[model samples]
Target: MAAKKKIRSPELEEGHLCYICGKEIHGDHVYIKTRRRSELHIHFECMPGKQQVN
Candidate 1:
């Protein structure tokens, strides 16, 4: 069976770090699951173009 993919909601609290740049996400960030199924929090700008919020 294939693994289920999902886009997790952003953390509303302050002090969450970006997965790519490691900088603090200011507001309205997003979290994506990698191939390994690990969750990573990242800023919208830091996310790759191939990844889109539905």
Candidate 2:
């Protein structure tokens, strides 16, 4: 059997533009920001993954 892929968020489901490189990724992507306290909108490489290291 083939593995099922994760679904993207609704905000980016249709399509998302990256802030850093202006890249576009479809499903199973991630969204990230340089600063945690940043109020500015950021969406680089389409989106970021759920895996976070702190």
Question: Cα lDDT of all candidates, in order?
Answer: 0.80, 0.52
Tens digit per residue, CA lDDT, model 2, 1-54: 999999878786557555556666455444445566642233433234635569
lDDT for 25 in candidate 1 is: 79
Determine the C-alpha RMSD for candidate 1 after optimal superposition of all C-alphas. 11.3
Can you give the lDDT of residue 1 in candidate 1?
100
Question: Between which residue pairs do clashes occur in model 2?
Answer: 30-47, 30-48, 30-49, 31-47, 31-48
Point out where model 1 deviates above 4 Å.
1-13, 33-37, 50-54
lDDT for each residue of candidate 1 in 1-54, tens digit (9 for 90 to 100) = 999998665554556889899998776989788999988898888878857669
Model 2 CA lDDT for position 44:
36
Q: Please, what is the TM-score per model?
A: 0.51, 0.28
